[model samples]
Target: MSESTPSTGASSPLHVAVGILTQGGKVFITRRFPDSHQGGKWEFPGGKIEPGEDTLSALKRELREELGIEVQDARAYMQVRHAYQDRDVLLDVWRISRYQGTPHGREGQEAKWFACVELPQLEFPEADQPILRRLWLPPLYLISDSRRFGKDGFLAPLERALKAGARLVQLREPHMPLDEFEEYARLIAGLCHRHGAHLLLNAEPESVSRCNADGVHLNGKRLTQYSSRPLDDHFWVAASCHSAEELRQAERLGADFAVLSPVAPTSSHPGAATLGWEAFSRLCATANLPVYALGGMRVQDLARAHQAGAQGLAMVSQIWGANSIERAVTALASS
Candidate 1:
């Protein structure tokens, strides 16, 4: 995430709701008219929410008006606040769980369904780029906890995890010396790139460019300090959040996702207060970015996390063994 380009005025942002309607493996998208704002760009089919409307109702109504489909079931996905040159807009994005009727462009716009992976190649508004990246993430985010497995010992299991289909990895060695950490990050980044997984350097924005990593994961303190994301749009920025306010701050800083911690009691920090699933879901609902349930989470908790509005789970100890790593990713991919 890079520093947000400041908006000139302090006007209240307009609220808009958008839908990602899916069928099979494809999601529906629409192209904006050449003469409209963000003209000639591809976007998910949706329109603005009315003053009295909630996101769900607004989504359902907008889908009918824009695409001639009735949304039967839909789930809130991500909320995005973007400042364009014209206006500051808050997008309430939802994933259409189920819908009825054939979809076509009712307003003379072009509509198409595309496989999720193919979306990046198409042109979209700058605000929509984060949403596209969020879609590429897998359900399990593996954070390297080298407490038990020393620096040298962690690589093998990590490799196994990557080979087994772990699409997201975070190299989080806070205790390691800078030199050692850089070396390890470089090695891990190569492995991740080779396996088509994305690697994030924990709390080290400066190291990302040096280590060839995909992004940086800010600790809570750094999350609070930085008003903008450190990197450009090509990099993925994430933060560790302990409370709803932190999660909101992460979104405000343009973070692509956040890992909310202590969702359950943890062995490392025994007796620490946990958010539990109910509280975790409550916090997640407020975030426009994808949220991962961290601290004491494991592969088995992935489905529950998703139900609680988390994009996935971020586990430390549970993802460190070859067999466990393989199984974790297998379950994640299957889920």
Candidate 2:
């Protein structure tokens, strides 16, 4: 069940701790009681942190009480704030990296383990959508510099990068002819599929199906025009956002993730107004979707970007060139 809008009241957000316990590649989830709050919804198991208890302590207690498992290891993943009409919630989500026993719902909820890829098909609290996005996003997002690499120049290095573990890539070629772009997209799709990477066209929705591309990356203008997700659920949709409101719009429109731009000065738009790390952090704080800090970013900035609340960094210029692709690949392992 989804949260209901409130009539009126002073909203006090509830701070709850949720555990994402994993085994192999699957995470554990539990179903809410059919008659309870958010009834019948599937959720990561956890409960409210009691007064005088810290997050970890509360989490351990909750798991022991609700799932009969002792938390062996866990780390904070992401923090989210969402508002239902009647209430606001602060979800302190954790990735339970390790645990001791088999999980069973002692509270009478049905428990199951699901691979992250299978998570989207389940019904969850609206608040968990952001968590899902975070899980789906990779730590490094790459954008093609086809303009600079020009005709046959970018392909080899791109394949090298993919072979070296580039998982998420965007083929952004505004200068290329439409026919050439589509042909290239087909080749790129084959390469990406071979490397088990996701390929997104920085083009129209129609272009995705034509080339077997995974999805479309909406330019800021296209992002604004869409009232809802432009493609169906199977396609992974992303957008480039420049402001907090744009990020909000991306979330509202069900974007899988977003690239928030001009986080630092870039050659892409010389002398453009930059959102310094402080401002960038502030913008990302309000975001419910995974956001990558774009503009003048490189492999070295991955840690700094993550520290600033970004899922990762998205790069173009820094990712292309003679030895830069190798550096970008090395950064992935480090990030």
Candidate 3:
């Protein structure tokens, strides 16, 4: 749940441990008391952390006290920092997949389960906006490599990925001329929408609307060029980041999410330094937006990426270079 209205308490930001409990594709949420902070709004279940307590410990205690459930399995999802007129808050969100005892609000609050699609219709605290996005976003991000596989060859693998449940994709053909890229993006957008998927163009932000794409994926250089978010909230704005500074910039620019790269060695940037899992995790811990691990990523690395605090894996070679596109897609979907 959203943090209670801050008392004239400490000047420091309140740290809250939030949990997103899911079962059968639905998430559990509770409404705050009318007099509480963000009153009458719906929020995922959780509470404030106490002194000397870590996030997981705080989450377990809060769930048991508020919902009578014992958290059995949970993982770091994402963190959000927000400020109100009177207070600042840090939401340490976790995905709780396994728990003991059915959840029912023990605190006399209205609680219920909601399908992910229904979440957008409900009112929630401002800080919860990113949390909702992370919940709805897919576990795999497919980056198009049309330069390696020409326009003719790209559609085949793309179709396979879409059919195999790849819901999010980035059309990243930097070498193509803008006009040509826009044309290709429109074609890809049509194909993506047909499969109930979203297509993000790696061209100029304005081209996203022109090509009828769902969003824009800015490269690191392009990301720093924007002082503010280029597009409105209706369009998803994503960025490619390699350092903590870029991540902070993405968040400051109101990006929906980001791709953090070089978690492992890659053929494309063989000489570039890699972040590795350790550094990747450290960077992710500080990011306010959901992050995807890129570079040398394969379907098998999905779990490892998750453990390292990445929302998912963003891959190019593993998906486009696979011998069997269908097999690769299947494996990634199942992972």
- Candidate 1: misplaced stretches above 4 Å? 1-16, 33-40, 48-62, 72-76, 83-89, 107-109
Candidate 2 stretches greater than 4 Å from native: 1-19, 22-66, 69-133, 322-324
The clash number for model 3 is 1
Better of 1 and 3 by lDDT: 3
Clashing pairs in 1: 1-229, 79-288
Candidate 1 lDDT over 1-335, as tens digits, reads: 11123345676777778898777767889998887778889998887777788889988888898899999988878777777777787878888888889899988899999998789789998888778898887788889877677777877777888888888998888898999999989988998999988999985699999999999999987888887878887899999999978988998888899999899998789998988999999998877888999988877788899999898988887666435668777888657
lDDT of 3 by residue, 137-231 (tens): 88889999887878988898899889988889999988888998899999999999999888998878989989999889999889989998898
Show the colliding residue pairs in model 3: 1-46
Please report, as a residue range, the 10-residue window in candidate 3 with the lowest summed lDDT.
Answer: 1-10
lDDT of each: 0.84, 0.82, 0.88
lDDT of 2: 0.82
Comparison by TM-score, 1 against 3, better one: 1
Report the C-alpha displacement of residue 279, candidate 2, in angstroms: 0.5
Q: Give the higher-lDDT candidate: 1 or 2.
A: 1
